[model samples]
Structure formats: C-alpha cells, structure tokens
Target: MAYLRLFDWYQTNKRDLPFRKTDNPYHIWVSEIMLQQTQVDTMLPFYDRFLTIYPTIQDLARADIDEILKVVQGIGYYRRFRMLHKGAQYVIDHHDGKLPEDYFKILKIPGIGAYTAGAIMSIAFHKPYPATDGNVIRVLSRVKMLEDDFRLDKNKKKLNEMNKELIENSNNPYLYTQSMMELGATVCKVSNPLCDTCPLQEVCLANINNVQQNYPKMSPLKTKKEIQYFTFILEYKEGFLMRKRTEDLLHGFYEFVQIESDSLNGALTQAQDLGLEIQILDELQPIKHVFTHMIWQINLYRGTISNITSPYEIVHDFSQVPIATVVKKQIKQI
Candidate 1:
C-alpha cells in the first residue's frame, strides 16, 4: 500500500526529462551511459547532438571511433565512450542492432552495469527491476533511516533486495523507478531538502526523526594526490609541436609537450633532451586541474624555436589539436 501510494504520487508529479519520453532501448542506453558521472544540465546539449548525428545503433556502429570521440569531446571519461562504441558494435553484429529485452542479456554488454541494466529493464521493457543510483540510495537511506554505510557491499546487497521488492509490488514499474529518482533529485535532495513539499514527509523516517542528514552515511573520501607538471608550447615558423597520448590515463588525446618535475628548470632540461633548441617566450599563469583522484598543478611555458624534430605532429592552429580539457584550457589562456 505504501509503495503504491508513492507510485501514484509519482505519476502526477514527475519531471519531464528527454530520456523518459520513449522506451527505445538505444536511446535509454545512450542516456544512461552518458549520465554516469555527468549532471543532467551538462548532458542535455551533448545528448541532443549525439542523437542527431547518430540516431541508430547501426549508425554508431558504422561510425569511426575518432569521429565519435570528436563529437563527445568536452565530456570527460573518454574510455566510457570507447566502451560504448564497442557495445554498439556488439549490438549491431550480434543482436542485429536490436537491444536485447532480457535483463541478464543486456547486462552482458561491456559498460552496462546493474544500475543501467535495471533502468533499461524498467523503462524500456517495463520489467520490475530497480535502478539504485546515488540519488536512489540517498532517498532510500533517508526514508528507511538506514544507519549502515551506504558504500559497503553488504548495505548494497540489502538495498538491492529492498528495491527488488518495491519493484515487484509496484503498479507501474516505469513510473515507480522514475519517481524514486525524481523524489531524490528534487524533494529529498542532498542538502536543504524541501521536506515541507515532499509527498513522503508524513512517513519519511529521516524527516520524522529529524536526522535527514545523518541517515545516508557516506564513506570518507581519499585525499587527492597533487603532482607538478610543466607544459611547453613549442612554436616554430611552420607550426606547433603536439603529441598524442597513447596510454590509459588520457589515451588518444593530443596535448603540448609535458614534463613532470618539481621545478621549472628541470622541465627545461628535459625539453632540451628531446633535441629541441629551446627559447623561453613567456611564462603564463599556472593552472590547477583536478581529476577524480588526482590534482595537477601545471605551469605553462611558451617558447619559439626552429629546427625542432620529433615524433609529434606539427599543427599550425592550436585549436585543431585534440587536447584534453585541462590542456586545452591552459593553451587558451596562454
């Protein structure tokens, strides 16, 4: 009865997001993959552009990886896009471009995890599988007054069981899934939740006990390790020198020559070792870029040189280089 009430309330009061309008497995899978670590507002334009370019699984499967990367530029996590490309190809080759309706079969895709599989099952196939993302976890913890750490595997198992039960009893599984996410996003927010307007306020455990902030206990975050980097803008009469990053961190992206050192002098020596006659042009401002687990303190050094030769490609325009967001910003500022 309580679950039905929540579902009923959700039917009338859900946000109209683009992904919620259709049950197309392709659309749902794309949106779910894009929204992994990205916020809704940031993803809106990108999602529209992506769908416009490659509207079907076949289109994406046939497209080149470089072309796809160009479209998804400015969105972080390049590896996710690569995996998505692989997944699309798999769908096209194995499933004839039709996404599988079975939950377990869909989960077999490279990037599709439990949350994504659940979302596709409920929204696309109308199956009773719950998508337990961060928002849902927060809402469930607060509503149930769970004291255990939400990040633990034991708690995750319990939460998944609770979610499965909720879905099984839900009158409309699609609406129920979206409603839970909507409530967490709008009413039962992380901080300063609108408890007065919340539909579940009457029975919400967090609100009744006045411990909303304490119910969803989060694990302590690890400190970001900082590293100093010196990036050189090596310009000659013809073009600038840039190299492609071929490793896991930022593979397939282009950036200016970077040297890891504690001091600027050490970076200069390293540059000279690369067989380039270095002439210091101007010292631009230092830039700080933070990744998920790493912090980079980058110092920008510009110089004009002649007779520079290396494996790097020389491009006349800096913007044409496929640099990462952090390196792109640093180049723009210089």
Candidate 2:
C-alpha cells in the first residue's frame, strides 16, 4: 500500500544485479541462499562461479560436496554452502527438480527459512508475502515508531505481520519486496539515513520525530567468546601438517594443528605429551579470526617437525581442500 514512490525509486536507483533480472525461482532461490549473512558485492563473484559450475538444480544436486565447498571456500560461513547443496538435492529428490511455488512446500528444503521462503514467494512467484529481514524490521519499526525490542520474538512477529499487510495491499508483490529491500539497503540505512531524499520519509515516524537512529530498539548482544590458540604449521619431509576438523563450527574443513594455550611453552608441553617433538624454526606473525559467537586469536608459528605420533596428514597442496578463511590467513603467512 502507498508503495508507488518506493517502486519508482527502485526502478531508477536499484543496482543492476544478475538475480534481479530473472524471475526464475531456482536462480532467485540460489541468490537468497547466498545472500544470507553475506553482502551482495562479496557474494556476487561466488554466485556467478557457482552458477557457471552447477547452472541448475539438477547439477547442484549431483555435484560432489567437496567441489561445492571449493567453489565457495572464501565466503566464510561454510555451513551455508553445505545446507544449500542439500536443499538443491532435496529439490531434485523430492520436488522433482523444481523449486516449489507454495510457501510451506518450499520451507521443506533444507535451508529455506521464513524470510527466504517469503522472498521466493513474493519476488519469484509474484505472490504477496512479506520478507521480514533485519532491513525490513528496521524500516518498518522506524516508520511505525515502535520502541518494542525487535530482538524479542513477539515484537518481530508484530513487524512481520505489519509487513504482510503492507505487501497484501500493494498488489505488486515483486516490486513491493524488491523496492522495500532496496530502500532499506540504500536509503534507510542503519546509520546516517538519507531522510531528506527517502521516498517513505513522510510515513517514517522516526524521521518526523527526529529520532531516526533510535526507533528499531534492540536488546544488547551477547559478548563474543575470545580464545587464544597457539597455531602450528609443522613441516616434515612430506609437507605441512593439517588436521581435519570435526568440530561443528568449521566442520569438514582443513586447519593447522592448533592448541588452546596462551603461551608457546604450554602448547609445547602439550605437544610433547602427545609424543610429537617440534623444532621451532621461527614464530611467524599472529592472526585473529572472528566467528558469529566466538573469536579465535591465533598465535601462528611455522617450524619443522622431528618426531610425530598424533594422527594428521601432510598437505602438499591445499587448493582442493575446503580450507577455512582463518586457516587460509595463516597459509598466507608461510
């Protein structure tokens, strides 16, 4: 409802994205999966590369897991790719190679959540549905001047319902979804919103009340757990030693042998107890990598190993392996 200005502005100002040019549900679904927890600019190349390789739901379903991971290695958050791969396969196996048009049916796919399902239905299927992402929440919360903490489930549901009504009234679901996304991303930005130029400035209560920054009230975030690890890259005659991580955070990826110790001496004692003797050649520069809830303060040190007993493999080349970005950073040091 009353989205003409927003739609007109989007037509003139929206960035030319590959996904925007197509109404194909498969393509849009791929884009939605990639865009989760990733910026458009960053996900663009990987999107292109992934499409070049997979090209269709069938291709994506049949492709090997390692190949899938290799294509999207540097994108961080490895689990997104894993789930996307499974979702595509689910489409092939269950939906007969077509992305479902029905909202509830599409959610059966492995990684398609409420927001993704809504996006697909509205944008690709041209059905009136609300895609209530963070941007939309911010925009709507500011417009209605709701001070309820959106972090809470009840407040979020309220915003989602409001957006649902707005989209239903628009009658042009595609433009309603895309235009809202564009407005939130480009104009009603988190900081320094361009209120004077915004199409919805008249409707935005926060802008009218001169409280643009305060409307979408949120609870404080949990503190990130910081951990110090003495990272090791011990080289034998074979190559560098790398451990296959089975931990949930970075599972099915390669990482250097790392021990949770603040000091090298402590790590060395631990290493000795494992029946491995490392001749420390030099201490390379340290690196820090931050995940969603945890931060790894990696103290990197590269050296040659004299004796070994713990199970690990020597990697001559790591190009094929699904190496995490943090491990890749340490790789750059050596």
Candidate 3:
C-alpha cells in the first residue's frame, strides 16, 4: 500500500546511522536497546563509548555490573542497563556467545522483549517481522485514523496485525521497517507533523480529513505522587556521607544521606536520633526531580561533623558515588 511507496522514498532519504551499516546482531541489539525511551542525539556518545569498551556480547556479559552502571551513569533507567548486562550473559552462556537468531529464544533473555526481538530479527537477520514501537504505532494510527486507544489490548492487537501485514507485503522488509520508523520520527511527528512532505499523505486518513494532530487519541496520564525528601550532606574532615539506594525506584544508585519527612523539623529530629551532630551549614532552596510516576521535592542540608564515628561512612571522592543527575547537581551547588 502506501508504505511501499514510502519504503521506496526511504532508500534515498534515510539518515545514515552507525547501526545500519553492520549486520552484526550484537551491535544492532545494543543500539536498539539504548534507543528505547532515549533520543538518538543523547545516545550517540554513550553508544560509541559502550562499543569501544565492550565490543562483543561476551565482553558485556563478563564485565562487572557496577562498572557498566558507572559507564552509563546519567542515562537514567539504571535497571535497563543492569538487564542488558544480564541478557548478554544469558546469551553467551546459553547460546554459545552468539545472539540467538530464533525469536522465541531471544525473547527468553532477561530484558529482550517482543519489539526489541522484532527489530533485531528484521534488521540483523533480514526477517519480515515488523518492529511495532511507539513511532510505528503513531504512523499506522494516523494513516488509518484508528480511533481506539492504542494502550488498550484490542487496539494494540489490531495495530500489531496491521504492522505484520504491512511488513509481509513489502518486497524489502528491512528498508520498509526502517522507513516506517523514519517517517514517523521525521515527517509524521507526534505534535506538529510535516504532512505536506509525507509520502503517505495521499492515503493517510488524518491528512485527508485534516485531523492529523487529533488521530491516535491518548488516555489521560495519572498525576505523579509527590514525595518530600530531606537530604543531609553530612561532611566529616575526610569526606561526605552518602548511601546507595537499594530500592526498586533507584536501585544500585547513590544519593546523599536522605530521610523522608513531612516537615523539616521532623527530619532534623530523626537525624539527631541517628547520632548525627545536627549543625545547619546552609538551608539551600528546594529542588524538584520527577520520575515516571513520582515527583520528588528534595530539601538539601549541608553540615559538618566533628566526630567521625556516626553510622554514615565518609566518601573521599565524589566520583565514586553513582549519584543521579539531581543529587549530583545539588552536591555541586553545595
């Protein structure tokens, strides 16, 4: 249908990305995983550094998880990096250091899901399967003007079926798959689309009906739950005290000595109970950080301790802590 024409157009117009030049499944898989929920511009440097350090699946599999986390420090979603490390080990140990060509086997890995598997299969293996990511979903929904919410099961099924048909009918499945993604990213954008230059504009229902921006209706997002955290930047003669968050939210990451409190006075009392000599150095302005489903209002406190026998351990170097950007910024300001 219209995707065939778009595919033809893409062969001449597609951007030259590093992953497109090689049929190496390891490289393709790594790029695909990093590309998820991360912009290409932001991922470029990280991808280069990652490939330089861990050139193969075996290298990544054998590398320490903490080292990998350190390399991918600011990218956020620390769990994805951990899962990638685990998945690499799984592939090497179970599949003999080679990525599995079979779709089901790939899906069995710790973090590889349907979309990632589909992408690797088509791009690396030249399979006819389509990668139904958010970009593909947007392109299809606007082309056919699907009214149902895409997040719902029924519409998702329909979109998957349509994506399969589109890929199966195309002569060059790899080019077609990449084309659909490129079209959505460059021309058929989420907000203000360049419909005039889109190859599918003639048949696109959204363009013909003049409702390109309104197609693919989305459900309202749930409001993020707000949490107030009192961060104590307790400094001794040698260094400052910090802790690694072991919880699921920011697991394996570092932060300042933090205590959840409803008010500032309560937080100070709690810190005093922990035997920390409460000396207020400075009360900085409140800092706000947002996660996927939560908002954090962190209040920073800088104080020095004469006695080094408190529960908090002193970190001599700031670079050792795998602190997120928000905490790092706060520390820098203090």
lDDT of each: 0.84, 0.87, 0.84
Tens-digit per-residue lDDT, 248-329, candidate 3: 8777777777889998889978877887666879887779999889999998888876654444677788776677787877
Per-candidate TM-score against the hidden true structure:
0.95, 0.96, 0.95
Please name the candidate that would achieve the greatest lDDT relative to the true structure.
2
The C-alpha local distance difference test score for the whole of candidate 2 amounts to 0.87
Candidate 1 lDDT tens digits, 90-131: 887778789998889888887888899999899888899988
- Candidate 3 has an lDDT of 0.84
Kindly report which residue pairs in candidate 2 clash with one another.
Answer: none
lDDT of 3 at 283: 84
Which candidate leads the pack in TM-score?
Answer: 2
lDDT of 2 at 207: 89
Better of 2 and 3 by lDDT: 2
Q: For every candidate structure, what is the RMSD over all alpha carbons to the true structure, in angstroms?
A: 1.7, 1.3, 1.6
Steric overlap count per candidate: 0, 0, 0
Ranking by TM-score: 2, 3, 1
